[model samples]
Target: MTDLERDHSEPPDCLSIVSQVTNSTRAGKRERLAGAAVRVLHEQGVEKTTLADIARAADVPVGNVYYYFKTKDQLIEAAIEAHGHHLQTMLDELGRLAEPQDRLKALLRGWIGERDLTAQYGCPTGTLASELDKRDDGLDRAIAKVMGRLLAWVEEQFAAMGRTDAKELAVALFASYQGVALLTNTFRDPDLMATEGARLERWIDSLT
Candidate 1:
């Protein structure tokens, strides 16, 4: 795989190839499957997405999906992991800002940058967790950890700003993002992202 495709939540050495019967080529196949899973799941959602659909999208045989992912849930987990890697990469980039408040605002702006995609598919993480929650699957916990990383990062910023209520503030901030994302998707309005992002920046400035 190319450098563009190789980064994962776990170290490359530690990433598990989904197919139990490891072969020279299976690793590449697994990567393709995981990438395809993320895209298909985002576009099609959990209920409508199927292993066969992912396989077709990947240009692999339908049976190969079973070889890579015994169940759709396993594929979902891989997609979540891939998303975690992407989120952490973004957070790391934002962390380079000299000010914590700037970092927080940058994160919100980053979401705003995806306004088009968010309008089409919603917040990828939020939508995945919500759909999984409706199904009563345990996968929501995995998403919780992904979200917790963001909340904890945000809380750290608030705490650094000397807010004793940092944790509550973080939750409120995240809840706003979730709500905005829902409305943005439901109404298919990119303007909601711009409006909410502006409002969020104002709130961030008030964090002092």
Candidate 2:
């Protein structure tokens, strides 16, 4: 038998060519599956999404999906992780801003701009959190963890402004902005964000 066939006949080993191929295939499938989830989650709320939907969206067999993700919750967690990484990259860029308030303002403005792009589609994690509430505790926790990172970053910025209760202030700011975006989306009026955002900018200016 050839060396390749000999390696395959042997017991499981990390260095085996067959093992390497299996790992590569698994990784590629995961990447495609994650991409499908992102697209569907952005276009449709989690409540409206299903494993079959993801499988079809990914152009993979339904049973094939089980080979990679044992449960829908696992897929959702992976999608959330991908989004968290993306948001972290955005935060890293914003962190480079010299002024604290400037960093905060840029962060807020960037979020609003992103919402405008998907105003019709709705926020990814926001929609998932709303739909998965009480339905899947694990998914709820995952979404909360991602949102907590954003909240923590905001609080850090407020603390830089010398606020004694930075966490509370950050929560208030997030609440206000979420309300504005929710109202804007509900009314189908994009200007609501721009108008209210300017007011928020003025308020932040007064802080320093």
Candidate 3:
């Protein structure tokens, strides 16, 4: 058999690769799958999205999805991981700002930047977390960690601003964003986020 053919004949590994996979190739496909999973799951939701849908979205073959993810849940978990990485990256970028309050307002503006997408599909993380919460499959915990990271970072910002009730303030801030995300999507109104996001920025300023 050709080297390429030989690669395909090997038994599937733990990640479900049925071929002899190079690290780079494997990582590339896995990244593609994770990225696709995030967008597809966000647009269609967890319960409604299929591996095939993800594959199509990723432009990967349907058979190849099984090579990277044994099940849809696994792909969903990968998407959550991607979301966490994205959240961390954003927070890290916001950290460059001089003030905690500026960081918090920037964070609000960042969400406002996604007003169109949020209005169409709801908050990507929020919608996915809500959908997964209906199941007992434990995926909710993974999403919770992503959320926990945001909450912790927000709490840290509030603490830096010298708020005694940092944790409670963090919760209230997230609650407002999440509530508006739901309303934005339900009403298909991008203005909901824009208006609420402005109010939130003002609220953050008031807290300072």
Find the candidate with the highest lDDT and give its number. Answer: 3
Winner by lDDT between candidate 3 and candidate 1: 3
User: What ranges in model 3 sit over 4 Å off?
Assistant: 1-27
Whose TM-score is higher: candidate 2's or candidate 3's?
3
- Candidate 3 residue lDDT tens string, 1-208: 2443345423233244443354444546777888988999999998888888999988889997887676788888889999899989999999999999999999999999999999899999899889889999989999999999999999999999999999999999999999999999999999999999999999998986
Runs with alpha carbons beyond 4 Å of true place in candidate 1: 1-27
Question: Which 10-residue window in model 2 sums to the lowest lDDT?
Answer: 7-16
Scored by Cα lDDT, where does model 3 land? Answer: 0.87
RMSD of each: 5.9, 5.6, 4.9
What's the TM-score of every candidate structure?
0.85, 0.81, 0.87
Model 2, 110-162: lDDT tens digits are 76786674356656666666677768357888888888998899999999999
Error of 3 at 28 (Å): 0.8
Model 1 steric clash total:
0
Could you tell me how far off, in angstroms, the CA of residue 155 lies in candidate 2 after the best superposition?
Answer: 0.2
Candidate 3, backbone clash total: 0
lDDT (tens digit, per residue) of candidate 1 on 91-205: 8898899888898899899899999999999998889888888767778888888988978989998888889999999999889998999999999998999898999999999
